[model samples]
Target: MNGRKNVVEVLIFKKEVEADPRFNVIGEVSLEDTDMLDHIGEGIDVKLIPI
Candidate 1:
């Protein structure tokens, strides 16, 4: 339990595949309050990395 990570839900869609896939991505992401604001201002795209 000490080393376990949390899980997050993400939607993945492939053009070839008619239906989207719902998957779980596990990890932690750290964003400071100010950094989050900056990301919004800069229009940064964030996606989950499979682990």
Candidate 2:
């Protein structure tokens, strides 16, 4: 992080998955809010803020 501040920003869309400690999951997105996943492989700037 090099002296930078760490923050957690989240965006919810519409799909859901189980969360486990094996992965560094900062939080959970609701099943009804997984639509944001569709943008995963596309090169785009996504800023997430929880609603």
Best by TM-score: 2
| lDDT measured at residue 10 in model 2 versus the true structure, 0 to 100 | 44
**Where does candidate 1 stray beyond 4 Å?**
16-51
TM-score of each: 0.23, 0.37
Off by over 4 Å in 2: 1-23
Estimate, for each residue in 1-51, the C-alpha lDDT of model 2 and write its tens digit: 599877554443244556656556556666676675776653555665667
Local distance difference test values of all predictions, in order:
0.42, 0.57
In lDDT terms, how accurate is model 1? Answer: 0.42
Model 1 error, position 33 (Å): 29
Deviation (Å) of 10 in candidate 2: 11
Model 1, residue 41: displacement in angstroms?
A: 32
Q: How accurate locally is residue 2 in candidate 2, as Cα lDDT from 0 to 100?
A: 92
Query: 16, model 2: CA deviation in Å?
Result: 8.6
